[model samples]
Target: MKNSVKYAVTGALAGAANGFFGAGGGLFLVPLLAAWTKLEERKAFATSVAVILPLSAVSAIVYWFRGGLDFMTAWPYLIGGAIGGIIAGRVFQKVNMLWLRRVFGLLILYGGVRAVLLL
Candidate 1:
């Protein structure tokens, strides 16, 4: 019951962040899932990806309906992102967890720094 509440709260927070930001829910989920569930780093990442897919689809639909999504301008990004995701998915299995964790930490750090500096 306690665990369920924790998961539900985290999931809600992740969904809200993704809905508001267009992306980034995985950032929230990764740490929470890893710590709360004691899931291995790789499994946490893979699980977060699975969880975010439906959240992203729903958010995209809402944005599209509200005239917030510009499909024409986003097509190029979508294509490149798809290619990048495919390559990363393949690479993820080969990468060591230590290196992967380091990279993830760097990215989160960079994002945090960038967000603060941009303001």
Candidate 2:
């Protein structure tokens, strides 16, 4: 029951973030899945990616229906992102978790700082 609630809340938050931001659900899910559900680091990261799929699909569909999606402009990014994802997945097991965490943290911090500065 507790686990279900945790998942439910996490899903809601992730879905909402994805729907609202077009991305970022995985960011929220990672910490929650790790801290709340006690998932291991790699497992949590993988789980976050897995969970993002459906949320992304739903968000994409809604955006498309609303005429907010521009696939032509997104194609290049999609291709590059796919390649990056493949490379990252292949290297995931080889990389040290501490280094991965550090890099991810830096990225999140950089993004946050940039967003704040932009405003």
Q: Considering every candidate listed, which one attains the maximal TM-score?
A: 2
Candidate 1 residue 4 C-alpha distance from true site, Å: 1.8
TM per prediction: 0.90, 0.94
RMSD of 2: 1.2
Residues 17-118, candidate 2: write the lDDT tens digits: 899878888778989999998999889999999999889989999999999999999899999999999999899989898998898899889978988999
lDDT of 1 by residue, 1-119 (tens): 99999999889988998998877888889999999999988999999988998999899899999999988998999899899989999999999999988988898899889989995
The TM-score between candidate 1 and the true structure equals 0.90
Model 1 RMSD vs true structure: 1.4
Error of 2 at 96 (Å): 0.7
CA displacement after TM-score superposition, residue 114 of candidate 1 (Å): 1.7
Question: Which residue pairs overlap in candidate 2's backbone?
Answer: none
lDDT of each: 0.90, 0.91
